[model samples]
Target chain A: MPTFADRLAEAVRQKGPLCVGIDPRWESLPKAIRDPLRDELPEERAAIGYFEFGRKVLELVRPFSGVVKPQAAFFEQIGPNGMEMLQLLLREARLLGFVTVLDAKRGDIASTATAYADAAFAGCTVDGDSFPVWDADALTVNPYLGRDAVEPFLTAAKKADRGTFVLVRTSNPGAGLFQDLVCNGQPVYRHVAAEVANWNAPTRGACGLGDVGAVVGATHPKELAELRAAMPDVWLLVPGYGAQGGTAADVKVAYRPDGLGAIVNSSRGVTFPFHPDDPDWEAKIVAAAQKAAAELKP
Target chain B: MPTFADRLAEAVRQKGPLCVGIDPRWESLPKAIRDPLRDELPEERAAIGYFEFGRKVLELVRPFSGVVKPQAAFFEQIGPNGMEMLQLLLREARLLGFVTVLDAKRGDIASTATAYADAAFAGCTVDGDSFPVWDADALTVNPYLGRDAVEPFLTAAKKADRGTFVLVRTSNPGAGLFQDLVCNGQPVYRHVAAEVANWNAPTRGACGLGDVGAVVGATHPKELAELRAAMPDVWLLVPGYGAQGGTAADVKVAYRPDGLGAIVNSSRGVTFPFHPDDPDWEAKIVAAAQKAAAELKP
Candidate 1:
């Protein structure tokens, strides 16, 4: 199997570096998807709705995007059934030839961290055969617990030809409250970015990008540009495009001049382009994904 | 419904401040637990073993400890069946009158964060009847995502009379990489501690602790003491004891003079003290939990 970075680079060359996000919020989903849910249980119904919405998003965006980053929380909200739904969606992403990044932000230490890595990357094995529980091509990791917390993820990803994106500069409003704090004469995010760069060496691909990636939010263009240079070997998963108020121009700063280093993502803006009542929702979603893909071209 | 702090305080007063961690690693499990493998699959047997081990531990420790902190990653590794096992174990904790602090480390932004909160604290509502998912009394959160990622957790915790403990100065060896970085003349974890203090105001209890708490590792005694002083109203969930190399004296710093603040946790040291081949495993586990409880006594 090719390294995740190599596979990602090939995918990017085929489809512009757009990473469509599948974030299906229960209340915001189209009634068309929600109405036909089989289970009477709200969580079950909502889980079904989320799965179908994700399936549709995959179908629409597979032609235009290199990656599909599914936010874990949206599916996790509905409990076990939701997780079951998420597992299927992940397998679907692989089957459809799209790079799947499970945006779980999972972080821990020792055996616990190893368990998370196994679940997300190499997956759980039974007998001689292995089952891909998440089977994600890559994962978004939190570095708060430090290196030991993230090492298992890197080790597992490397072994499986997968990748991981460490959170560096997030796009949320309160992100600056902690990330901007000056640590060692520089911002905390910079330190995180530096570590991300160091971790990349273990699985650096022929494309000059490493399996270890960095999540640099498009909300802070200046920081994004700075981090881009700081972690040249790192692939940046740039969120905050579209609905998060980050424009395409803001996200462009994260990409290299050669247009092969960053993946700009749009979730609600692409998946739920219309109100809940819209009749022609799927087409609009496809159109929105296309527009996002074109606009995000570096 | 009493506030989470109120309930926690009562539980602690009745059972002391020991928080036994449920870390069901496969290899370390007792021979008796793993020997009964009717299933052909390893993960299936491992999942069953983990669930049974958790059940036995809950039964043993419920009499001596106020809380049980189940490491989420261990259960998540076996797919949705493992999650179902975890859900059952969480329910078991509730039935046994122990406050469940799910060590999920889940953090995200906006509605995604809200979804995680609902899954952990508020419980997912389906068919007009709300279904408790993890339904933990409190959760351990990763603060690397900043305040917005943590806000929904606090809000839902407040609404549901639950609680959360945001990671401050972790006990891991590489925790200093970013956490101890001097930002704006103070460490990054200090800034995180300050924010935890701020978030606590929304759900302060009569005992003076708040629904929003801090996870200060036992390995970092000085920082734990400093963070304790910095956030007086915050409930601290201190991990990294025994098996993680932190002594009882190190964890003692997190407690208030009144003996009512921090909850010290012990995982492998308590849960898997005897070798996997030990015949009297239950007795050993009980003894370990007891010793840990006594050592962590305020």
Candidate 2:
């Protein structure tokens, strides 16, 4: 099996840098998807709707994007059954050859961190028998708890030949509250980026990128470019490209000359481009994903 | 129902501030718990073992503690089945009159953040019908994403009459990697602590503490005291009480003069004091909880 970095690089080469995010919202889901499950229990209705919509979105976006990220929060809001739905969607996404990144943004301390990592990558072992959980190719990790918290995820990922993207400069407008605090001479996000670069140093794959990546938002073009120069060997997972007000031109600087250094993500802009009442929602999704792929092509 | 702050204040008043953390590990479970489920599939065995052990811990610690924190990572490691077990444990803990804190350390951007917050409190609404997910009385949130990210949690928690504990200064040895950087003449964590104070201001209850709280580790006694002074009106959820090397005396300063400001969490020290082979595991747990409760009483 290829390293996570190589697999991601190959994905970009085959289908451009577009990574469609499957962030389904119950209210935002097409009526067509929601109406069929109306008679079931609320949890069941939402879970099945999310799964069906996610599966359809996966099929529709397959031609335009080689990587898909399923946001874990939405499914989790529907309870345990929703988590089961998320598991099924992830399995289907993998079976369809998409490099799935579980966007759970998990972080903890020591052995606790190891538990979350094992769930995301290697699966759990019970009395010597192993069972896969999320089993994502990569996972989004929060870096707030510092080195010990983040290292477990990196170690687990490395052991499983998986990957992790650490949050650097997030796209949210309020992100600067703590992330931009000038620590020493540089902003805090820069410090996090430096650490990410250090973490990515030893795991470089044949494609010149490592399993450790940095999530630098497209909303921060200047900082994104600065981060690109600072971590030349790190793969950048650029979110906020479309719905969050980041344009293609804004994210173009995130990529290396070979065009394998970045994978731009578009969630609502690609998956929920139409209103819930729209009859042709599936077509709308296909068109949106196609447009995004074209615009984000490196 | 009273506000989350008042509820916590009442708990502390009745049973002191000892918050027993239910972090179940398969290998750490007593043979009695694991042996019964050995013939089941790996996921089932792990999930059932966690559920049974967690239920037992709740019953055993009921007299010594009024609060229980279920670490989501440990249960999540067992997959969706484990999540269901976590849900059951939370329900049982709540029913047993223990104030439940789901220590997921969840954080994200905008609606995504809202999605996570809703799962923690207020449940999810589908076609006007709401369904509870974790439904924890409180949740542990990561503050790295800044203002907008943390506010949704506070909002949802407030609406549901629940609570939140934002990570300010963690207990890990390498927590200072970013948390202790000199930002604007103060450490980064103090900045986070100040913000927590601000967010906690409007939510103050009769106890003079607020629903928005800060997580300050017992390991850093000096910083814990500093944060205690910094956020006088905010509740504190202190971890690293034992096993992680923070003595009872180290956490003494975390509480206010009135003894209503902090809830000290002890995971392994209270719940896993005995080896898996020990038939007296339950008694060890009771003794540990009793000792911890007696030492930590405000």
Find the candidate with the highest lDDT and give its number. 2
RMSD in order of candidates: 1.6, 0.8
- Candidate 2, B84-104: lDDT as tens digits: 999999999999999999999
Estimate TM-scores for all models: 0.97, 0.99
Q: State the weakest 10-residue window (summed lDDT) of model 1 chain B.
A: B37-46
Docking class of 2: high
> What is the C-alpha lDDT profile of model 1 across B1-298, one tens digit per residue?
8889889899889989898899887777888877776454765776788899999989987778979999999888988778888899999999889999999999998888998999998787654667878999988888888878888888898888889989988888888877888867788888889989989976788888888889888888888888889998899999898988899999888888878888988888888888889999889888888888887788
**Candidate 2 pairs with clashing backbones:** none
Q: After aligning candidate 2 to the native by TM-score, how far in Å is the CA of B113 from where it should be?
A: 0.5
Return the TM-score for candidate 2, rounded to 2 decimals: 0.99
Q: Can you write out model 1's per-residue Cα lDDT over A1-298, one digit (the tens) per residue?
A: 8889999998998899899898877778888887777446676788788888889889888788979999988778888888889999999988999999999999988778889999998888643556768989999999988888899999999888899999999999889888888765788888888889999976778888889999988988899899998988899999998989999888888777777899988888888899989999888988998898888876
Q: Which residue pairs show backbone clashes in model 1?
A: A42-B126, A42-B127, A182-B183
Q: Of all true interface contacts, what fraction is found in model 2?
A: 0.89
**Which candidate number maximizes DockQ?**
2
lDDT for position A103 in model 1: 97
Each prediction's DockQ against the real complex: 0.69, 0.90
